[model samples]
Target: MRIGVFLVAAQFPGMDSGDVLRATVETIVAAERAGFDDAWIAEHHFMSYGVCPSATMLAGVALGRTERIRVGTAVSVLSNRHPVALAEEAAILHHTSGGRFVLGVGRGGPWLDLEVFGTGLERYERGFAESLDLLCAALTRPSVKAEGEFFRFREVPMSPEPPGLRPVVACTSAATASLAAERGLPMLLGLHIGDEEKAEMIGHYARACPKDVPAPGHVAAAVAQVADTTEQAVATLKARMPEWLRPGLAGYVPVDGRPRPATDVDAYVDRLCRIHPVGSPDHCAERLRRTVERTGLRHLILFVEGAGDPAATLENVARLGAEVLPLVRDL
Candidate 1:
């Protein structure tokens, strides 16, 4: 299986913007040294929740630093940018990186992203579909033509022929996953759902994909921490979980039905560990293997720097690279 790191440019309580950016690049370098196949960058804006506003720019920085490992955006929010500009930027990066650049696309989330970009949440999905259509046409065809509900464009041709780029979609729902299948694109699944939900989503994608066409290998990202013993891993989670589960963070809402308060550290840690791949090397390897078998995921993107605690996060990356990765290398 192909394995990689998903760089989450998370800003901890005391970290400045520069600190977050530096650490993100450092994580990419470390992942390359650790023998990761790729490093995917995420885009976030107008919040310390995630400081990186341009994942493509960060992907360029990572490409400049690492020679072997592939780099791509975990997702560049399509709803937030003009498709032409994004296609041009990504195509340039792809050319510059010798075709190692991947253009992962997604709809900007319903929260701060849309509000700050002056995009309406009501039309977000429609806009996303329209954007995806335009983006695909722009990246593949010599010229672009769109008369969709959300975007209207003339026959504007992209300069310098587009490369052979296979884009992936960051899918959070079965509908979007099916959309990926329809477009013959791969899907990137996050670790926010239960195992049953994951199974169902994967099954849906597999079924929706055409029988004559080869199914694009799907990727799944997980929050991970490994140590000598399960107890040690749990201890690290206990220490870092509170900060990671801070209130108002996206994707982390209810602490069992109510909004999570800052004090709900233990409960939050338990919840996170229950759904993520966290344990000793052997333990993690077995779980990951089962995940691959069950979900038919060919790539696993490990989020090693879960809490943004530099010391612990780096150690987790190192240990995962040294211990866990070798054990599960064949998976």
Candidate 2:
């Protein structure tokens, strides 16, 4: 029932990176004004899919600009950075933001990012658990040491001393979901999957979680656009979103020189429109409520920027808060 906006800083066709970043910040501010509970910043590298390379850095900007809304990384790619380094940034943000920072980490794809960052494909393929374990230790323990396969370090005291931080893991598979459950951390489900898949993942987490740990509330990401009528909302997204999606989806490059799957941009958009809350306020609210009921998701982060237009995106955020939220807040 806790609603939020997912900021991708997506560079649509004919838009500059600077403008996209500024608009993303503006969206975060608008989200807080519109009564959103959180703003999740996405991290992408070497692509027009998302220009923001540093989710934590953008999160700092958002936290500084907004007082009430919690700021988090949709994911800081753990495969590309040292876990201790990310932990330090998380701790600093948590301390500075008065515990309003949520650290969400993920094992990014086997993209060229691994090559550029020099982490190699092995890190992305087999190093996530070690990195995640080190990250958790860095955040919770006063002093941390690691002797894992991917990382080996001497004991070092945590600076800024993580203010009781509990990171959310971005889970794309049962293995990842079980890993998160084993650590007693919640999962951040992506926008690509449907309710049934998400419910299955949650079931995996529930079955794998230790008896000593209480069930963690999971977060779900979904596309949302609000308009006076269903036709208007669907039309707006269909027209504007493909402009952003076509190039963005084609930007990924595999690290090992293997060909990546081609995404059918229009077909993907159509799928999202069918599955997500993209319609009139009443319809959007009902869709969201159904999603919550079906998946048992406690938090919902809506991709309000699906229109790929700043003004329309802002309007969507405001309308979502004003009309859609009231109907679904109690769910």
On TM-score, the leading prediction is: 2
TM-scores for all predictions? 0.91, 0.98
Q: Identify the candidate with maximal lDDT.
A: 2
Model 2 per-residue lDDT tens digits across residues 247-298: 8977788999898988888888888998899999999988898898898888
**Model 2 segments more than 4 A misplaced:** none
**What is the Cα-based lDDT of residue 234 in candidate 2?**
93
1-331 per-residue lDDT for model 1 (tens digits): 8888887688767778888898888888888888888988888776665788999999999899988889988889887787778888888988888888988888756554565566656557577777787888778888887787777767877876766577789989888988888888888887666556777888898899888778788777887888887777777777765674563164433212444334465776676676667888887788788787777777888877665577667777788888878887787
Candidate 2: residue 143 Cα off by (Å)? 1.0
Determine which window of 10 residues in candidate 2 has minimal summed lDDT: 158-167
Q: What is the lDDT of residue 195 in candidate 2?
A: 90
How does candidate 1 score on lDDT? 0.77
lDDT scores of the candidates, listed in order:
0.77, 0.91
Q: State residue 146's C-alpha deviation in candidate 2, in Å.
A: 1.4
* RMSD to the hidden true structure, all candidates: 3.5, 0.9
